[model samples]
Target: TQGKEKVDDAEEVKFEIWKKNSDKNSSMLEAKHDQHGIYTAKTVIKEPGTYTVQVHVTARKMHVMPKTDLSVN
Candidate 1:
């Protein structure tokens, strides 16, 4: 998955990917923060199974937050 974020402040945004079916105790993928706080992460699946993709977005010292859900077949 890939995404981009636009910010007016100089603060940096962090993004991470995790599995929804799991206990939410670990991350499946993590992307490095760019200059614009945008990032991209990849998840690999070998077997035919259903898995969910979770995207978490957070900014430094900011209240603005967002999340997204994705499905993989």
Candidate 2:
């Protein structure tokens, strides 16, 4: 027997990119999603340093935020 599953809603995904120790230079990532629930955003780094990328997701009154460090040369 197969079980039925329902997807009432989906989580909103967003990203924030900024250089380390700099708050004024932060920018929001414009992400696009496909039918497979994959989100993607494109950005260009003009400086060479350590940067932070944060992924924010919200769904059903719940929120999740994850961050990572990135370096560009």
Candidate 3:
């Protein structure tokens, strides 16, 4: 997944991934500075299951950013 963002004020942005089926777990995949906010993640799914991707943008405050769903076959 790739896109552009227009932010008024922000210090940092984070990209993360996790197994959607599992509730007690989350993984930190990548992080980027507020200025150079370009990022990518290399993830491995062990089982055939659903996964989630979230982008967290933080500056003066924090936001949930966006979410995505992935299916491993």
Task: Name the best candidate (by lDDT).
Answer: 2
Model 2 scores a C-alpha lDDT of: 0.73
Q: Write the per-residue lDDT of candidate 1 for residues 1-73, one digit (tens) a residue.
A: 1225564342333444445666665454555555454566555655453444444444444444366665556
Better of 1 and 3 by lDDT: 3
Report the CA-based lDDT of candidate 1 relative to the real structure. 0.49
Residue-level lDDT tens digits of model 2 in 1-73: 0124332344677788889988647888766665445577887888999999998767567777789999999
Candidate numbers, best TM-score first, in rank order: 2, 3, 1
lDDT scores for all predictions?
Answer: 0.49, 0.73, 0.66
Taking all chains together, each candidate's TM-score versus the true structure is: 0.43, 0.72, 0.58
Report RMSD (Å) for each prediction in the order shown: 5.3, 5.4, 4.5
Candidate 3 per-residue lDDT, tens place, 19-48, comes to: 787882888765643344444456677888
